[model samples]
Target chain A: MKISGAQGIIECLLEQGVDTVFGYPGGRILPLYDAIYEGKIRHILTVHEQGAIHAADGYARASGKVGVCIATSGPGATNLVTGLANAYLDSVPLVVITGQVSTDLIGADAFQEVDITGITMPITKHNFLVKDVATLPEIMRFAFRIASSGRPGPVLIDVPSDIQLDVFNFTQEEEQEKNKPRFQWELSQLGSSLIDRAAAVLETAKQPVMIVGGGVVSSGAYEQVVALAEKMNAPVVSTLMGLGSFSSEHPLFLGLTGMHGHKRANLAVHGADVVIAIGSRFNDRVTGNKFKYAEGKTLIHIDVDPAELDKNVSTHIPLAGDVKQLVTTLNERIKPFNPSPWWKVIWEWKQEFAVKPDGNDLSATWMLKQVAERTKGKPFIFATDVGQHQMWAAQNLHIETPRSWITSGGLGTMGFGLPAAIGAQIAMPTKRVIAIVGDGGMKMTGCELFTAASQGLPLITIIVDNSSLGMVRQLQQLFYKQRYSESLLPVPMDFVCFAKAFGIEGTLTTTQEEFLAAFSAAIESNCPRVIIVKIPTEQLVTPMLKPNSPLDTFMDI
Target chain B: MGHHTISILVLNQSGVLVRVAGMFSRRGFNIESLAVGTTHVPEYSRITAVMQGSDAIVAQVVKQLEKLVEVRAVEILPVNTAVVRDMAMIKVKAAQNKKLEVLQLAETFGAKVVDISNETLMVEITSGKTNTDALIDALSSYGILEMIRTGVVGLQRGDCSIYEKEKCEISALFDTAQVEA
Candidate 1:
């Protein structure tokens, strides 16, 4: 039947199984907002467009479904760029629908007009500016398909105000999808010869270490990775993005590997004779000194995204396909083997660098440990911003489920945690979504607290107040002779009052007991709450490895 | 120098060219030459890009190009197995006294005199890199005034099309990859 462009968009969203969208409405998007007001789909009004997009990203990460968001033209569109970039780097699937100026006024310098398609061309997987109402349904379908398929990423569709005002029959546009060109290089499952070759590499390994990355989480290959790790009797190490792919409490897990990675995991990769890299593109942080990264290891790299195969570090054997499929095939083909001799060294390193919570006056790691202990055997998602607190959260939080750990690993975008927790909580309502944010990063997007609190989301923002950019300060102290330039926050910004101002209950905890009490109360409250924990300024991410250094060589802290 | 030519078959979409070209600059790979034209197929635009880089970097580019949604297929054309050519038009200031010499030089290089003026001769030539550059160098002696060259473009010199079922159809491999080991 006939429908307005706004209704057509809502129809497409429903067709694609989208139940909710996050966006900040504006004058240009009034038509779409009217449809949203009258439609069945839920729309969240975030205080900022950046918060909306990031929440969508977090929802996608937590729910394994394509997240949707919207914004008006110009500055509203521009505000979504950083979030789109973050989702792009993390490979999170999103369909961003932005309102645009009228067709006649597009380049006429009308109010709120911007070249969003041109601006987002480099960042989005693909984008389209809809000038014709006949193409609305088709463009919307294409947006979701492109965003969710292959290597998942964000796709933007700029709907002009006049186009949204136009009326068209959805059936007419449905026929156009049949003629759309199919991508030939859409990731095809590779020939088993490569799998055979990979098995041969595994067969000859004396000390094998399986390193998983974000690919595992994105591909939902958690069980297969666990099976392979168990079958081979190998220790599993994850990159920052791979945190939730395998259980943190699993016996075989060796924690994160790379710069600021666990010493056990780093040393394990360094000592490995054969490294099976699953889904992790060797990021620069992970492959510090690519020349010396895996010098003697027989590296087998597997990734769904073919471009990532040898983009960073050269691999001896490259398997390009879906991680879930490849890992399953590997599990079936490779015979169970024991690497206990190698595990002897691994266990030694694990014990030597084990995380022990001692006398804690709200140290980042110690606070996270208490949270982890209290929430043990329970479902929780720890979303973090970038910094020492992010590393601490990754190291200390017990994420037993896939998609439980949501952090901006690739982009390391600050102000990500709070908004991300908002998305994750909305996606997984029953689970506790904790925003483990730093003092520095929280200031970037703290307005998202309004979004969370107003929605009555039970997200806990555990803002670690170190009164400085602790990670940057540590870098300066180490290499710059302790010249703390502009790294420290100028004033003592009380996060508790900030939360209270947003109509959310909050508490300030200076010690472990107080923090634990407040945290327990927040958990029992079943509503949004903020707990500001005061961490000492000197506390830094341990075992910091200088860039371009081998993983095994860390500076003496 | 690790110079390679990549031929891409893409959906004739409005932004496909930008998407393909953007991938190169996005990855920091300098493009030596790039040419785009319609193909024999109705909905396909063929892009031939020449670049200088290590084999690994070029391979990475090819892989990245294939990931674009509008890209139908990407193949790295080997220099020996491909028929790469560049076309150029050179205007030389061969006044009345030197017009014959310029004409004779164009003839020797099998270049066509596409345009002529009272004081200049514009010669057009299509050839491989060496011959194309050599002809321009030969005309430079006659005081070349202006010149324009189409960047390199070509396909594999054989019966094999990029769309051959044996090459493009991924199902056979997909079937094998799907079977339980």
Candidate 2:
């Protein structure tokens, strides 16, 4: 059956199991819009392109599938750049389709003829410029495969205006089978060898520590990492990205290490004889002063991307493969080593770095804990924007499995949580989806609340109102001689009024009691709910390893 | 860390050097040296960078470079068969009639005496990294005053291009592969 390129796109999406697509139509993408109307796929029209892309991102992070977004060329495509880059940095799977000008006018500088494929290349996992109708099927399949594959990210498919009208004879099943190839983990073999080497190193070490990163979540290996740590009787220290990989309540948990990490976690990593890193890139922020970070320890880094290993710190055994597969193999092969002294020392460090907020009111940490408890063991998705709220959530949230906590890790994108939560909720309607955003980050994409309301997704948004870019202000206060630059904005917008404007119930809380009530109400609300918690602007993320310093060289709080 | 050679074809424009350099620095990819020059094509320039990293990371870097808007193509040339060269200009203090001896040293290293003044003698040398190091070693005894060295520029011999290899791999998988025809 011959079908238009636009219909081919719809067909390809349906074949990929994509039921929902978030987008706004324009003159350039009218053909695509018409095709979508005729097709069975559900399309959610967002008020803005930013909202559309973010909603798609939210859906992807929550569901662990490729989130789809469509937009016209020029401004529509440009608007989605931030979200694309956001997904790229955080490694979210997204398929973005943009309508381009006619193929003939592509380089003539015609109206709405922006080179979207080129513009998105740096920010996407892969991209294709489809000029012919016949190529659409294969390109679309390749786009989804690339976006959802190892180290998932955004993929852009720019469909020319002329091609959208052209006819093609291609069936969905034939295209899928032809395009999809087997992706095996040959790297896992290398990973197994490295694991044995790591075990050997661990056997001789007196104090061993496991440093878990976002890769564990990416690989759905959180439980395996925790089990491996417990088996080794070792303490677990996490990077900012590694938060939620280990339970905060676990006695072996040593909190986050690196810049803005806990003091004791930094000390634990610094003093350990062996440091086992899983699914982390070990960015400079995590290492602080690299010279002093884990100076005497043997660093064993296990990551899916072999490039990440020894890219930062020198490693003894570099394991390159899937984190889950590697951990599972390691758990089965090695005998549990007894490290009683190491466990005791880690326990001491945990006590020393006990993060007890001075005020008894529902602090950021307390709020996260409450949410974790309320959600129970049932699979729930938690998304967070950047700043103190994100760190606190990571430190406090009890994530039992992977894909549970989604945050902008690599990019540290601020306006990521709410839209991501909406996406997650839309992808899995029955799952409880929560987005934790700070005042600064909330305002960045706060308008996304309407998308959630319109979609009828019962997403719970917890806004930590700090009235400033808390992380930047804290840095300025600590590092820049207390000169707070443009970090402080004017009087904050009324979040409650903002939520009401979107037809979502909103509540404001100041004390711990009020927070508890508001949280319960928000969670219980059938419709999308927003709760604004007023937090102090002066509060700083403590136990920080100051910038340009080693992780272990943390300022003692 | 083994050394690797990466060739990037970028749109000829200003600030491209800074943009490319910034990417390497931001990603923490250590660049031993980088050289950029105009290609045979008027609108395009070729940038050659020599860096040290694991094979996996170098491949990732190549993929990242290929993604840059200004970058048209990226080729990772094997180090063994590639010819890597660097250019250096150094000014050395010459007292009395010692200029003849310095010129002699320059000639021995296949260097040319570009300029000669009463107080200083400038020598220009273009050679591989090893030869450059050796020349610099011999000139160090003359109390080198000022020096400028361009990073290594490398090119592979013959027609065995990286793009050709990639195309071959694709072709091997699907016999119908014919450059999107």
Off by over 4 Å in 2: A175-181, A187-193, A247-251, A357-362, A489-492, B1-181
- Candidate 2 C-alpha lDDT tens digits along A1-557: 88888888898899899999999898789899999988589998877898789889877876777899999988999999999998887777899999999888879999977877667656776667786788788778777766765667798888888899998897766655656454455534555577788778887879888898877766778778878987888878887766767876677777777776777788778788898988888888788776667577899888776556666776888777667777888777767887888667766766776767646875777777778788878868888888989888876777655567778777787787887787778888888888999999898889888888888888889998878888889878877888999998668679999999999889999888898898878777788888988887887776666567755555554
Cα displacement (angstroms), candidate 2, residue B51, comes to 6.4
lDDT of 2 at A27: 76
Off by over 4 Å in 1: A172-190, B165-181
DockQ of candidate 2?
A: 0.08
Name the best candidate (by TM-score).
1
**Candidate 1 DockQ category?**
acceptable
Q: If you score just chain A, what TM-score does every candidate get?
A: 0.96, 0.94
Measured by TM-score, how close is model 2 to the native structure? 0.80
Candidate 1 lDDT for residue A164: 93
Q: Of all true interface contacts, what fraction is found in model 2? A: 0.02
Candidates' TM-scores?
0.95, 0.80
